[model samples]
Target: MVDHKQYTYRVIWSEDDGEFVALCAEFPSLSFLAPEQSAALEGLVDLVRDVVADMAANGETVPAPLTGKRYSGKFQVRVPPEQHRSLAIKAAEQGISLNRLVSSMLSV
Candidate 1:
């Protein structure tokens, strides 16, 4: 059984609902809201547990928690030729590689 707690979760105050809203990154379509932050998170966790159980019982593939995945720290992004050139120039001016420049910008 997948641990429900392994999924990424966030709780934020919802201005429109006037409550704390709980969200799970793995299950974007599911949410729970409550007057208290704890309740909101607990409710969402319970919901995810139930859904995961249902999915498993029906022989469906459950999403792996992001935390359980391995990343190579490398990804490709496509940019227009002009923008690429501009970035390359900036990197040259800063005495850094184009990849370093882009990585710094993205980190900001």
Candidate 2:
């Protein structure tokens, strides 16, 4: 049976080419390039699995998902309308939701 433990990936957009890129960040050499977004992502997943199997045979560490406590918190903050608008625009530019942007900033 094929081992499903192998393969991990993250999808990111390439600003210069206006295309989506799937990066196996843990195994830099494992990547895929395709003109279509879905194909590129699917190819990346396959490549990552192959790379992981090779690494396993070589006795290298297989990539594993992080396991940690999930954060659950909620609060409300008051900001001026103009500032809120600016924050929303900045978050959109970074391709993240406003809550994520604020949470990251607050974490640091």
Candidate 3:
């Protein structure tokens, strides 16, 4: 079983639930809500551990933790033709490649 701690976990206040909610990115469907942030996170960790064990016991594929994965620093994004043209023109005006311009925009 994958280590539950290896998964990407986040605890945030949920306006709808009026409680702190813990979420595991890899297991989108799973969440734990509690009045306290620590409790929410701990509960979600236990939930992830159990789910991972069950998946292993059932011989089902389990998702790899985001922390354990390698990133290539490259991804593809598609934009509308007009938006693409605008971005390209902006990049040219700035004397930079589209990729660099997009990277700068995203960084901001």
Candidate 4:
């Protein structure tokens, strides 16, 4: 049997759009969009599997989890109330905590 622990996907809901988004927490880069949370999650899983398979075929190593020491910093910004609400809703629908969503975007 193939090793199953190599890949995994997670589902999150977006409150603003009222739809679910899939995120591959294990492989942060793998994500998918769908009308429903379940569909998005399923799609992400398949996508990650395909990516892993392709990497294996090409004799490439699957990336390992992040481990290097991370730096800490802080900043402040102003956003309209409506925009903040929309962002919160979107974060909720993606099933990710708002902090994570914001952090991910900021990192990018």
Candidate with the greatest lDDT versus the true structure: 1
lDDT of each: 0.97, 0.73, 0.96, 0.73
Q: All candidates: CA RMSD in angstroms? A: 0.7, 9.9, 0.9, 12.3
Ranking by TM-score: 1, 3, 4, 2
The 10 consecutive residues of candidate 1 with the worst lDDT sum are 1-10
Q: Which ten residues in a row have the lowest lDDT in candidate 3?
A: 1-10
Model 2 lowest lDDT segment of ten: 63-72
Tens digit of per-residue lDDT, candidate 3, span 9-105 = 9999999999999999999999999999999999999999999999999999999999988899999999999999999999999999999999999
Model 4 lDDT tens row, 23-80:
8656776678889877897787778778877887888886653343255666666889
Q: Where does candidate 1 clash, by residue pair?
A: none
Q: For candidate 1, what is the TM-score?
A: 0.97
Full-model lDDT, candidate 3: 0.96
Give me the runs in candidate 3 sitting further than 4 Å from their true place. none
Q: Model 3: how far is 19 from its true place, Å?
A: 0.9
Residue-by-residue lDDT tens digits, candidate 1, 1-108: 899889999999999999999999999999999999999999999999999999999999999999999999999999999999999999999999999999999999
User: Which TM-score value belongs to model 3?
Assistant: 0.95
Candidate 1: residue 11 Cα off by (Å) = 0.6
* lDDT for 62 (candidate 1): 94
Judged by TM-score, which candidate is best? 1
Clashes of each: 0, 0, 0, 11
